[model samples]
Target: MNAYQESLKIKRDNYSALESAELRGEQRGQKQGEQRGIEIGAELERAKAEREKREMAVKLKTKGMHIEEIAELTKLPIEEIQALV
Candidate 1:
């Protein structure tokens, strides 16, 4: 190939390499974002469930239920349920 043509080919090669690297970087970023979103959603769900359990424990406590029974039914620590009194 002529010098001019050879120079053009090298330029095109460099551009293609850059484009491929950019695409790979974007894909990695998107995957990381998705994983983080999933983790946040799971954490929120766990928090919600814990809140519900505590509410139930409070209700049972008001109903004159025994502390040990409340702990077993709500899957809460005895000390935690006792603190609700």
Candidate 2:
């Protein structure tokens, strides 16, 4: 083949490879972003649940419920329940 045609072929191959790499990188980035979003959502849910449990434990304590029973019902540590104001 002529030198000019060979050069054009090489350029076309390089461009195709670059495009493929970019597409792969973008797909991986999107997957990572989605996974991070799910992780954040789960953390928020766990934090909300923890807050609810603390609130319930306080209410039970105010009602003069026994500490051990409160710990069991709230699934909070005995030390945490005792530390509640």
Candidate 3:
């Protein structure tokens, strides 16, 4: 091939390679973001369950139940009920 033709071919090949690399990078970033979102959602669910359990303990305490009895009824640790009181 002539020098001019060879130069044009090289330029085309370089452009194609750059385009492929950019597409692969974007896909990798998207997958990482999705994984992060799933993790955050799981954390929120765990926090909500803990809050509800604590609220139930407080309600029982307000009803004049002894801390030890409350712990037995709620199946929670006596220390946890005492802390709520």
lDDT of each: 0.97, 0.97, 0.88
Across 28-49, the per-residue lDDT of candidate 2 in tens digits comes to: 9999999999999999999999
User: Which runs of model 3 end up more than 4 angstroms from their true locations?
Assistant: 65-75
Supply the TM-score for candidate 2: 0.86
Candidate 3: tens digits of C-alpha lDDT, residues 1-85:
6999999999999999999999999999999999999999999998888788778889989988788877776677888888885
TM-score, per-candidate, Cα-based: 0.92, 0.86, 0.78
By lDDT, the better pick of 2 and 3 is: 2
Query: How would you order the candidates by lDDT, starting with the best?
Result: 2, 1, 3
For TM-score, the strongest prediction is 1
Q: Which regions of candidate 1 are displaced past 4 Å?
A: none
**Among all candidates shown, the one with the greatest lDDT:** 2
Clashing pairs in 3: none
How large is the C-alpha RMSD of every model relative to the true structure?
Answer: 1.3, 1.6, 2.4
